[model samples]
Target: MRNIRFLVVIYLICQNTLFAQNNPFYNQWEPSPKEGAFQMEDYIVWGGSVIKGEDGLYYMFASRWPKHLGMSAWVTNSEIVLAVADKPEGPFSFKKVVLPARGKQYWDGMMTHNPNIHYHDGKYILFYIGLNYEFDQPEKVGATRELYEEAWNHKRIGVAVADSPFGPWKRMDAPILQPRPGKWDGAIISNPAPVIHEDGSVLLIYKSAPVPYPARNQNRTMNFGVATASHYWGPYERKGEDNQIKLLPISSDVEDPYIWYDGSKYHMLAKCMNEAITGESGAGFLASSEDGLVWKTSENPIAYSRNITFSNGEKVNLPKLERPQVLIQNGQPSHVYFACRNPEGQIFNMVRPLRRNQ
Candidate 1:
């Protein structure tokens, strides 16, 4: 009996060692902006998403505002632009604006922001937010102020399509998801990122605010939720409520969700107001789920900024780092690209390569 017990103890020790090696967040922290990469531009560039296409280049979709306007301009006056790089770690060159301000005759007729892009079924779909202002008089600029006040009460998540990564894209005539009247997502539905399953179903993860509450000028809470569709273009339904759309259980005041699978389990990285393990802003938290619907978060943040500025001379360690997009090489996360805000608290597009081995 004593000999048998000794063998069991040895086997258990080996099993625990193997398990520890597989957890990606086992290490405390890792270095970013790997050697020899150009730092990001100092200007405000938020809402970044990256894609490596068959053309053998990296394409990034980001929200940009002029330097003179400051960060708040994104709420009133910002446009989505595309940037291209020969490699994931830039020197990236500005391409062109993807979504211009709406013309006339649409709800999102004024400002456009919060871009997330994903390729599905041989096409690229871009999701973003559109704010509409209803002017009392078309001729008077001052009257437009009251119009915006009423419209600013809500925002919608809109979708657009492109045949190629770099393209003259086509926008959907209407939004895929909108705010519900008295629910968790009633106030607003923005920041959309689509997840495509192997079985050909699509899941959309987005941020929302409560309705019948305070105005944009007032303080409000933003939460995340998921919606599903049998096809990429639907009539998509929420996970619960008899296809009536339901919200996810976890509540962390989190935004900008990026999801991925590692063959064994699904993982997510999101931006939160809560202090991370390092107790700093711009720190990202990691979570895992055996099934995609439920999630388990780590006690500490898995990723944080090291106070290294980008090439554009912008301070790297600001409180605002939203939109976490993962680069999967060989089926694992090799790098993460985020929307980094400047020292003054404006958003900018930046990329940080992860040390997977660590």
Candidate 2:
């Protein structure tokens, strides 16, 4: 009887694994670059956050801008818009704008981008980066040179709460995470992706850049950083304030950090501009951490668009296909999404598959 019971348990485990592999959306994603995948002829979609709502639908919150303005215009001009699809690999239909320009009443009153959505305590929290007037105006642009400098001095990370994923979200009156004095992130606090541990503490992974010495805009290098809070609506404290947020065991020029816990360990996928590898553009690099604070990049890049192409004739070779985001269904990773930019540098979110066997 004991031998039979042990065999039954082993058979059940194999069956469960087979069922998970059979899931269509599981390990079945591909770049949904159908002709006219983007609804607007002139606007490109980028910096999106995806969530599976209670209504059994997938919703994406992304930044959109007029194609004529180009990707560089995202800083000063882009707005956050909503798109929805019946499935994860979407022929997603454009929905209404979530956050429009605030018209100078508040700091992020000009542009809202980098939407990161997660559900906590029966509420959905939308964390994002907002550009204030200090960073948006052309006259003040010289005050800060690098992306991190501008983000620290001008941008702020804020959160909004709603009962449902499709929210009439109530935003916190003040920013949740801001720059501090003499800290690695003291220069800027943006790219708000949060990971909730089993113990209920929230670990928010973000990007920060130190102010360049010579004050050259292009010299600035963005790196991944972390902050922690006892509660979700946090006055999040940087992990190593006294020691400084350690750069994720990789060289500089990494950003758009997305982190998750894969059963036993924490994993991260980020976009890095490593000139040595691709010559000009960069690729997506994978990293892992035993604890959330320390990170080491894998010797090999997990994915590179330069080696792949989409159906819509978008060559992944260019400096495009950054901002990697993954989709989890029932606690297992199923899909990896990337922001595929065009020749003019306009960004559109694209999907791809993730399976070891594949």
Reference-based lDDT, each prediction? 0.64, 0.66
Task: Tell me which residue pairs clash in candidate 2.
Answer: 42-67, 152-187, 152-188
Candidate 2 runs further than 4 Å off: 1-32, 36-39, 134-153, 181-183, 198-200, 212-218, 241-249, 275-281, 299-301, 311-316, 344-346, 355-358
The digit string of per-residue lDDT tens for model 1 on 1-358 reads 9989999999998865564344343342344443222223544667567778778888877777655555445655667788888887765677788887766477666667877777777888777787665542232223334444455564677777899867777876777777776777777777776776766577777777776344545647777777877766667766643222222333456677777777677677777665533355546666776655676764543554436554445445555566777777777666667666456554455676655553
lDDT of 2 at 275: 56
How does residue 140 of candidate 2 score in lDDT? 29
The 10-residue segment with the lowest total lDDT in model 2: 136-145
